[model samples]
Target chain A: MNIQLIAEIMGTVAFAISGAMLAIERKMDLFGIVFLGIVTAAGGGFIRDMTLGIVPPAMFSSPMVLPLAILSSLAVCALVAWLYKGSDEELHGERFQWILNFTDAIGLGLFTVAGANTAIDSGYGDYHAFVIFLGMLTGVGGGMFRDVLAGIMPAVLRKHVYACASLVGAICYLGLLCAMPRGYAMFTGAMIVVVIRLLASHYKWNIPRVM
Target chain B: MNIQLIAEIMGTVAFAISGAMLAIERKMDLFGIVFLGIVTAAGGGFIRDMTLGIVPPAMFSSPMVLPLAILSSLAVCALVAWLYKGSDEELHGERFQWILNFTDAIGLGLFTVAGANTAIDSGYGDYHAFVIFLGMLTGVGGGMFRDVLAGIMPAVLRKHVYACASLVGAICYLGLLCAMPRGYAMFTGAMIVVVIRLLASHYKWNIPRVM
Candidate 1:
C-alpha cells in the first residue's frame, strides 16, 4: 500500500478511538457512542471533501474508514472499562491515564501531518497556503466537533495552544517539503507537534484570552 | 427601499418574535433570550447565503438585519407583556402563538418565492436549482434550529410536516412562475399554506410515524 493510504488508515484509527472514549466519558448509550465516534473521525474530512466539490468523500469511498471506525470504538470502550474498573473501589488510576495520554499525543501528532499532506497532494487548485491552512484544521476539527456534541467547551477555546501545535507542524512540513528526503519531512513535522503538545500541557500553556 | 429588502425584514421580524417567545417560555435570561431570538431568526438565511457563495451573508452585510432582529425581539416581548396584563383571570393566552403561526406561514411563502426568483433573476446557472432548494429550506430551517436549541424535537421532524409544507409552497411558487401572474400566484400560495396549517392543527392531524 502507498504511504498516503497507510497514513489515512492510521489517522482514522487514532481519531475513532479518541472519539469513542469521549462518548463513553459522556455516558452516551452504545449506539450513540459508536455514531459519535464515527462522526468525529470522519466529519471534518467529509466536510472538507464536500466543500472542495469532491464527491463521495474518502470516509465513504474507502472500505477501510468504516471498519476502522467500528474497531477503534470497540477497542476504546474495552480499554476504558479495564482502566476505570478501579474508580469505584478507590482513587482514579493515574497509570492508565499516563498511557492514554501518551497514545493520544502520538495520534494528534501523526494526524496533523497526515491531514496537511493530503491537502497538499490533492492538487485541486489548492496550493501551499490553502493546504497548510486546511490541513491543520482537518486534523483538529474533528476533536473540536466531538467536544461540541459532548456539550463541553472545545479544547481549542480552552487549553494549550492545541491548534497552534497543528499549525507549527504544518509549517515544518512545508519547510522541508522540497528540501529534505521524503520520509524525513513527515517525521520532523509529527515530532514538532508531539513535542510541542507535551511540553505545552506540562506547562499549562494557553493562548491569550480574548479581550 | 427594495421590495426584496422589505420582504426580508418582514421575514426576520416574524422569525425573531417566534424565537423570543420560545426563549421566554424556557425562562432564559434576557441576554440569552435576545441572543437566541436573533440568531434563530437570521441563521438559516445566513447559511443560505453562504452556501450560495454570497460571503458574509446579507443578514450580516445589510445594516437592516441586526437592527430588525433587536426591534422584533423587543416588540414581541413588550406585546406579550401587554397582552397578559390586558387579559382576565384565566390567563390561558394564545394570542402570541396565533401571531407567530400566521406570520410564519407568510414568511415561508414569501421567502420561497424570493429565493427562487432571485436565483432565476441572477442569471445563475442551472445549478441554481440547488439555490431554489436552499430557499425552501431557509424558510423553515430557522424554526428547526430554534427547536433543537430549546431541547425540543425539531418541528420539521414532528409537526404538521413543516418542511413538506414549505416544499408545497415552493412548488406552487414555481407553477406561478410558469403560467399565472406572480402576484396572484404568491397570494394564493401563501393562503394555501396558512389554511392548511390551521386546518391540520385544529383536527390534531399529525403526520404518520415512520421508522
Candidate 2:
C-alpha cells in the first residue's frame, strides 16, 4: 500500500481508539462510544471536505473509513470491558495516559499531512494560509468534536501545544514541498508533527494561558 | 424578495443574535462574539451544502449572509451594552429568555424549511429520510456549534422539542408539497415548526430522558 493510504488507515484507527477511550471515561453506553469514535475519526475530514466543497465528504465516499472506525471502537470497548471486569479502578494511570497520548500524536501528525496534501491537490497549494489552516483543522477538529460531545473544553483550545504542533507541521510540509518530492515531504512533515507532539507531552510543555 | 430569501435572511439574523447573546454571557471579547455569531448563523448551511456537495457553500457564495450575521451580532452586542450600562444584573431573566427562545424558534423553523427545500431542489426530493435529516440538521446544527464552543451540552439534545419540532415541520412540508404550491408549502411548514417550538417552550414540554 502507498504511504498515504497507510497513514490514513493508521490515523483512523488511532483516532477511533482515542475517542472510544474518552467515551468510556464519560460513562457513555455502547452506542454512544461507537458513535463518538466514528465522529472523532472521520469528523475532521468531513469538516475539511465541506469547507473545500468536496461533495459526499471523504467519510461518506470511502467505504472502509467508517468500517475501520467502527471496528476499532468496538475493539477498544471490548478490551476495556475485559480489562476492568467490574473493578472500579481508574483507567487513566500514567502509563495508560502515555499510550493514549502517543496514539493521539500519531493520528494528529498523519492526518495533518494528509489534510495539507488534499488541499494542495485541490489547487490551494499557492494559498499557504488556507493549506495550513486546513491541515491544522484536520488534525485537531475531530478531537474538538469529541471533547465538545463529551462536554469538556477542547484540548486544542486550552492545553498543551496541540494545535501549535499541527501548525508547525503544516508549515514544514509547505516549506519542504518546494524542494522535495511530495512523498518525502509528506513523510517528513508527519514525522515532525509526531516528534514535536511527543516531546511536548513528555516535557509537560504548554502554551501560556491568558488568565 | 421571495419568501425563501426572506426566510434565509431572518434566520441568519436571529441565529446571529442568539450566538452573540451567548458569547456575551460567556464574557467573550468582541472578536469572539462576532466569530461565534457568524458560525451560529451560517454553520448549518455550511454543513448542509458540504453533505450535498455544493461548492463554496451558501455563506461563501451568498455575499449578504456573512455581512448580515456580522451586523446582527454587532447590533445585539450594542443593544446589550446600552441596556446593561455597566450593571451587574444577569441578562437571562424570564423576559429575556422568552425573547431569546422566540427568536430561536423562528430561526430554527425558517432554516429547517430552507434546508429541506434546498435538498429537494438538489434532486434528493425522493429521499424522504435524507430530506428530513438535512432539515433538522440545518435547524439545530448552528446552535449545537454554539453550545459546544461555550462548553455546554447542546440545548436541543437536552431540553424542549427542538429537533422533533424540526422533524415534524419537514414532514409537514413534504406532505404539503403534494397539495400546495412550493412557496406555500415552505411557508406553512416553517410556520408549523415555529408554532410547535413556541408552544413546547411555553408549556415546558420536554422529551423524556433515559435517566
Estimate the lDDT of model 1: 0.68
Cα lDDT, model 2, residue B201: 80
Estimate the Cα RMSD of every predicted model relative to the unseen true structure: 9.0, 6.7
Best by lDDT: 2
Best by DockQ: 2
> What would the per-residue lDDT of candidate 2 be over residues A88-192, giving only the tens digit for each residue?
445666655776678788889889999988898899988999999999999998888888877778989766789999999999999998999888998899899
Output candidate 1 Cα RMSD. 9.0
As a TM-score, model 1 comes out at 0.56
Name the TM-score of candidate 2.
0.63
Per-residue lDDT tens digits of candidate 1, residues A4-122?
67656776777787777667666665554665677677766765665664434567557687778888887877766675664643222565445434545565667677777767667
Runs of candidate 2 exceeding 4 Å displacement = A178-181, A206-211, B1-117, B123-136, B145-152, B156-211
Please list the C-alpha lDDT of all candidates, in the order they appear: 0.68, 0.85
| Model 2 per-residue lDDT at B62 | 94
